[model samples]
Target: MSNVQDAIVNAKDKLPNVTPTPPGFHPEASVHELKSRLLWGEPGLSIIDVRDHDAYNQCRIRGAMNMPMDRLPGGAEFSLQKDRDIYVYGANSGDTSQAVQMLREAGFRRVAELKGGLEAWREIDGPLEGVDSMDDPGPDAYNVFARLQAFNEEKAKEKRMK
Candidate 1:
């Protein structure tokens, strides 16, 4: 039929199947919701860390950009489109809400605050960056590859005890 219709059919065939975001979602996103969107391969979204630089550097959601609350106006204007899907977080709920307000006032239409910050992200095992952000630190402080060996040792000790 129409070229636009044909293109839509073709594109739908090529794209991976993904669950769409539900309607009626609030202006705040839970860590689980953001994680689900990321897992579903959603694109054209930005995750912003509105905490201080040191806190961001110490640990933050993987791929999150550090745009401390004070700098949101200029930074968002320079780097983000007004209609971009932006999820921002800060030190706490109040800070996140404040950052969301700043972004909205600066003309960002699709901004949402991430509730519960990094601690909530940690609960869902969301990816993070930093030395302390490892999902599995194993039992050794100095050896990165020691987990398997430790597991084997534990198994052997169990066998001996049995």
Candidate 2:
């Protein structure tokens, strides 16, 4: 083999084998996995919400930074380390994967799509902010909505006691 060919082979070997994905991790990380990591106090990672500004501002996972999908490259480049662990989610898995693909193409080495997006996070009772308290009852109160309703009920009970 030519010297250049040998060098190329060496470089390829150094790159991670992304096809099979690393053991104990997936290209799309589950909400449970992320929750465990947060509980374990894992460091060297960042979560990105790729939804639009309005949605992100209205409600988002606590500690997640906004980096809208359309603005990913520019939004992330200045603030985020290319090699650090990045867990990203958008409106759904497809949007999340698209963002992840873009980040990888832009030379980010450790971007992972967050599976099930914000809904799953909320299901797991993950921390969140920017959501307004619901004033009226709505259909299908469960998970996050259930928690909010519970809070409101507790507050009402307290007021009655007072």
Candidate 3:
């Protein structure tokens, strides 16, 4: 029994239970607070929506820019100055965190994630434009919508040919 206990202690020591930082950007404020900050806070903060283009166009924070995660690293076309605060958010938690990390790696210093993503924004009654608030679709839904739209256009062309 002592030998087994010794082995267990050794194994435990070898396996350091390091808690990873909670995934996603940690917002300094709730959605309402964010809204107020954006609208009333000091100048220089930029809101960045890290979802796809369609999602961004469908409905997003009024002035937020669409900076998709997959296209990051080499695809970013903006000049984000090091001194400005950058707020990032997506449809959900995990993706937003991943986006924040990518931005940090790409050299963004002042970065934060909207707590709970857009869903939380809706919860806080944050205003949005374009699509309805009820139409908060996930990433996969956006992909499906894009494919369907393409297929519909192709079918229209075929009909015109006949």
- Tens-digit lDDT string for candidate 3 (1-162): 246655764564345325211111233334643554443323667788888999998888766878888777454436577545778888788888888788778877667777766777766555576564454434543474553443344333423534
TM-score of candidate 2 on Cα atoms, chains taken together: 0.65
lDDT per residue, candidate 1, 1-162, as tens digits? 246755764564345335232111236777765665564445778999999999998899988999998897799999999988899999998999988999999888878888888998897667788656765533462453453343334333423534
RMSD of 3: 18.8
Clashes of 3: 1
In model 2, the clashing pairs are none
Q: Lowest summed-lDDT stretch of 10 residues in model 2?
A: 17-26
Rank the models by lDDT, top first: 1, 2, 3
Among the numbered candidates, top lDDT falls to 1
lDDT by residue (tens digit), candidate 2, 1-162: 346755764564345544211123346677765655554445778999999989998888878999998797888888998887889999888889899999989888778888889998877566777764222323533455554444444333423534
- Could you tell me how far off, in angstroms, the CA of residue 149 lies in candidate 1 after the best superposition? 30
- Whole-structure CA lDDT of model 3: 0.61
The weakest ten consecutive residues by lDDT in model 3 span: 19-28
**TM-scores for every candidate against the unseen true structure:** 0.68, 0.65, 0.59
Give candidate 2 regions above 4 Å deviation. 1-25, 133-162
Q: What is the TM-score (0 to 1) of candidate 3? A: 0.59
Best candidate (score: TM-score): 1
